[model samples]
Each structure stands twice: as C-alpha cells, then as structure tokens.
Target: MKAVILAAGYGTRLLKDLQGADEQHLQDLTGTPKPLLPIAGFPLISYWIEALRGGQDPIDIFIITNELYQGKFKDWAKNYPFVTVISDGTSTNEERLGAVSCLQLIIEAFSIDDSLMVIGGDTLFYEDFHLQDVVEEFEVLYRGNNQANLVLSYTCKDDETKKYGIVETDESSRIRAIKEKPSPPETASRQACPCFYLFSRHTLPCVKEFLNEKKDAPIDEKDAPGHFLSWLVTRRPVFSTSIAGRFDVGNLESYRLCNKYFQENIRKLNYLQ
Candidate 1:
C-alpha cells in the first residue's frame, strides 16, 4: 500500500519551542514541519519509513510540503528509496488544500487506485505496530462489502476532549457518531481520532462530493481531516480500529512526552541503527 503524509502546514504553534534545535531536534522538539528533525539521532520521518519497511507490502511514501520545505524534505528522503516529496508552493491554510485535498492531489498525480494509508507527518507511534496490518484489515473489510473508510482511533486517558476529534462506536466497532470536540456531556467514550486513516478506492468519490458541497461554503475552522471524515461517516459505513499507542508532537506537553518516550525507548527501535 501507499502512504500519503500531510506535512504542508506551517506549524506556527511549535516554532517558539523549536527555535534553537537542529533539523532533527526541531522535529522531535515540536512535531512541526521539519520532518528531518532528529529523534534518537535519526531523522523523524526515518522512523516512519523504517516502520513501513517492516510491513508486508512494499510501502511507497509521498510527503506533501510547501515550497520552503521541499528541498529540505528531498534532502531528508534521499537515502530512502521508497520515499518522494512534493511541494504545494507557498500557500496559506486558506489558499492551500487541507489533508483531504492533498490526498486527492497525490492520487491524481500518481494515478494510484489501490488502498491508500493516510497519516499526519507529526504523529509518533510504537514501532512494533505493523501499519500494514491495519491496511490489510481495511482491505479485507472493503472487500467484504463494507462501504466506508477506516479510522484509527486511539484511547485518550485525559479529559482533553476539546483537543481532538471524538468518536462514538457501536458494539460491532462501527462508528455511530463522530464529533470534532463536542461538548463533554455528549462524548460517548475517550476514543479519539488520531491522524491515521486507511481508505479504499471508494472513498475518493465521497471526498469529491464533500469538496463539491464545500466549495460554496466558507471554512471557519482548520480541522480539514476531521471535516472530511465527518462527511464520509455520514454517508458511508465507517469503522474504527484502536491504535496501540499514539503521540501527538504538536502540543507542547505531548511533544515533550514523545521525546521522553523516544529517549527511554530508543533501543527498541532498530531503525536508528
């Protein structure tokens, strides 16, 4: 399967904390756009590439970035044979396409039709978890006549429901409702949407439909992926799978936590060597 990484955002929220770090340090320090930032002495994206390498399928990676970071991403990905980087030019959040739009761009550009895995560039996860397994299961469900997309849900231990897209699922693991940080009393469970998603070819039409309908409306928020998935679940049979571990590098506290986790667990990751 192929993976498309959404990395075009400026990550302005993380700049202050990451100012003095080197490339790799910048990545681990803030979970920002610097994919080359160091995590345990290797580039941040390197870990993801290595994890995909361990998958059963031949994983092809495409990183979407803005013009300013394209050259850096190319340089960072040079040693990885299965990775490619594309620049979306210098566009603001409003001017540029969001995660879903970037996925569509990659699909059209590469002519990809098979199942695709979409991940946020800044997310960190356990190396032992085989992302391909998720993709394979998603393919199975799709072939079994399941007509919706797959969302990787992570159980959050905190009361920070306001920080994420919350999910409510039925006993069969089918998504019953998804809210982008709904009021606390309305939340069904702590299961929240991480940045990972598996989509079949069937999802493209839904995306196109969403885009067509959204073209006339004004965007008030920046959660593009959440908006897309919300639209998909409303029209199709969306299912949820739990991620073993998930870390968000965007927030200051989570960024620090991820760095600490990596430091303590570095030896577990063979990719560094």
Candidate 2:
C-alpha cells in the first residue's frame, strides 16, 4: 500500500495562535509548518513516520507540501529512506492545491497503482492506532469487492460536531453521507470523519473525474477532502470504522494537549518494553 500525507495547508490559524502565545516553548512555532512543529522530542510528522514505519505493510510515504516549506520537509525526510517529499508548486496560501487536489496530484505524479492510504500530516491518533489494522481491513473489503473504500471515524462531543466533517452511516455502518461543518447539524450522527481514508486502486480514476467536474468551481468546492468524500459515497460503497480518538492540532490548546498525551503514551510504552 502507498500512503499520502497531506501537509500543504498554510497553517494560518495555527500561526495566528502562536503569535499570541506567551509560552516560551511554543514561541519558535511562529514560522513553522504545522506538521513540522515539534511534539515531545521530534517533529509532529515524525511520529507519523515512526508509526507508519512500525506497521506491517511496506508503505511508501509521500508527503505533499507547498513550495514554501518543501525544503523543510525534504530535510527532515532524509533519515527516512522510504519517504519522498513533493511540492505542489504553490508558494502562498492562495495558490495551494486543496487537500483533494494535492491527493490527486501525488497519485498522478507518483503513478501509484496500489491501494492508497491518505492521512493528514497535522493530526495524530491515540496510541492504539495501528496502520496495519486499517490496511488489513481495507484488504478484506477490497478482496470481497474491488470498489470498497474505507474511512476512519471517531465519536466526538455533540457540541464539537459542527467543527468537523460529520459522517452519517446506515445501520450496516456503510457511510451514507458526509456533512461539512454543519451548524445545528443536518444529520443526527456524531461520527466525525478525519482525513484518514483507504481507497482501492480501481477507485483511483474517480478522483480525477471528481476534480474535472469541479474544475471551474470555486476552490471551496474542492478544498476539503470531505466534500469529495460526500460526493463519493453517493456513487460507491464507502464504509466507516470507529477509532478511539484523534488529536487535531488545529489550535494552541489542542497542540498542547496532544503533545502531552503523546509524550505520556510514548513513555508508558517504553516502560512496558
């Protein structure tokens, strides 16, 4: 399987938050890309690299970043021989290829024909997250039906539902629809879908078709991967699996909490060994 890490976001909100932070430890984060921000003792993206490397599948990591920070990612990737850094040729936030576009770009640029696994570079999950398990689940679904696509979901607080792409699933747990940041939600389900997804190789062409259909539309049309996913569920059989939880480093409070939990998780694991 191949893994695509979407790290092209401009981190405008994160940078803005950092600007007002009084903590000395977080001061250096003013100009840093969200993925490159340090957590525990290493860059946030490095934890993903470590976790993916620990997985059973031989996943080739493809990190998609903007031209502004491509060199930074490239430098950090030097020790991980399995990783390759690619720039979307956009120097500024306005020029960025949206997450969906960046995903399609890496797929085309790398000529990947295998089952694809996509994850957000700025997010990490609880210690129980196993890439191999997700890959195995995808393999089972794909073998049963080649068109199967999988997405990860987690239950968040009811009030927090409006901040994420809420996925509504049928009784069988097959995803019925995805609602993007709906205030006073359009659906009753609290399944918040993160950026993690597994797509069978046969479903790859559909990405291009989706993009082509929205070529002239506003960038918002393709900005969130959830938008594409919402459209995708209508045409194909997409399913969801619940995870313990995930930490989205979108703001200062989240980053602090995630870093603390991650550090403790690592320390506990080391103690157990």
Candidate 3:
C-alpha cells in the first residue's frame, strides 16, 4: 500500500497565534512549517513516520508540501529515504491548491495503482492507534467489497459539533451520511470524522472525477477532504471505525496536547522503539 500525507497547508492559524512570541522563537518558527514543527524534540510529522514504519504492510510514503516549504520537507525526508516529498508549487495560503487538489495532484503525479492511505499531516492519535489494525480492517472489508473505503472517527462533544465534520453510521458501521459542522440536535451521532482514510485502487479515479465536478466551485468548498468524502459516501460504500481519540493539532492547545502525550506515552512504547 502507498501512503500520502497532506502537508501543503500554510498553517495560517498557528502562525497567527505565534505572532507576538519572542523574536527568537518567532524567527525560529517563521520559515518552519507545521509538519516540521518540533514535537518530542523531533519534527511533528516524525511520529506518523515511526508509526507507519512499524505497520504490518509496507508503504511508500509520499508527502505533499508547498513551494515555500519544499526545501524544509526535503531536508526532513533525507533521514528516511523511504519517503518522497512533492511540492504543490504554491507559496502562500491564497495560492494553495487545498487538500483535495493536493491529493489529486499526488495521485496523478505518482500514478498510484494499489490501495492508498491518506492522512492529514497535522493530525495525531493516541497510543491505541495501530496502523496495522486499521490496515487489516481495511483489507478485510476491501476483499469482501472492492468499493469499500475505511474512515476513522472519534466521538466529539455535542456542543462542539460546529467544529468538525460529523458522520452518522448504521448498525453495521457503514457511514449513512456526513454533515460538515452541522447544527446540533440534527443527528444523535457525534462521530467526528478525521482526515484519515484508506481507499481501494478502484476508487482512485473517482478523486479526479470529484475535482472535475468542482472545478468551477470556490476553493473552500473543495478544500477540506471531508467534503469530498461526504459526496463519496453517496456514490460509493463507506465504512467507519471508532478510534480511541485523535488530536487535530490545528491550534496551540491541541499541538501541546499531542506533543505531551506522544512524548510521555507513545515514546515509551516497546514497539515504537
């Protein structure tokens, strides 16, 4: 299987939050992107690498970044020759191609044919996250039904529904529908769908189809990957698996929580070593 990590985002929120930080601290982070931000004394994206490396299935990791941070991502990839970094050729957030577009870009650029795993570069999970288990689950479902796509979700607070893309699932764990930041009291399900997904090779061409349909739409509509998946479940079969929890790391608070948990807990794991 192949894995694609979407890291082309500019991390505008993170940079804005750190605007008044001390000059040295701000200067240190000015050029550094979120995926390269230090966590547990290493780049934040390194955690994903270590976990993926330990998985049962071998994966050729591909990282998609922007022209502004291509050098930084390339330098980080040097230690792990298994990873390939590709730049989307956009420097700023305004010119960014968005996550869905970036996925399509890498898919066509590499001509990926096998099962593909897509993960948000800024997202993290607790120690319970086992890439092997997820892969196995996806394999089982895919073998039984080639059109199946496995997505990960975590229960979120009801009041926080406006903060994420929520999903409703049937008794069999098949996704019924997805609502992006929907109003509460609409659905009893609080399954907050993250960006992690496992797609069968048969479904890859549909990604390009989605982009083509949305070509005339605003970038924001096509930006969040969940939006594409929302449209996908209608056309294809989508399954959901509940994870222990996930850290999105879009803001300062979540970033600290992710680093602290991984450093104190994930770093001490026997398998991780």
- Candidate 1: worst 10 consecutive residues by lDDT? 25-34
Model 3: per-residue lDDT, tens digit, 49-139?
9878987657799999999999989988999999999999998899989899999999999999988999999887766777788889999
- State the lDDT at 211 in candidate 1: 70
lDDT of 2 by residue, 103-140 (tens): 99999999989888888988888766776678788889
Whole-model lDDT values for every prediction:
0.73, 0.86, 0.87
How do all the candidates rank in terms of lDDT, highest first?
3, 2, 1
The 10-residue segment with the lowest total lDDT in model 2: 264-273
TM-score of each: 0.87, 0.95, 0.95
TM-score, candidate 1, is 0.87
Q: Clashes in model 1: which pairs?
A: 23-37, 24-37, 24-38, 25-38
Clash pairs, candidate 2, are: none
A best-first ranking of the candidates according to their TM-score comes to: 3, 2, 1
- lDDT for model 2, please: 0.86
lDDT of 1 by residue, 218-246 (tens): 65332368878877787788899886667
Displacement of residue 182 (Cα, Å) in model 1 is 1.6
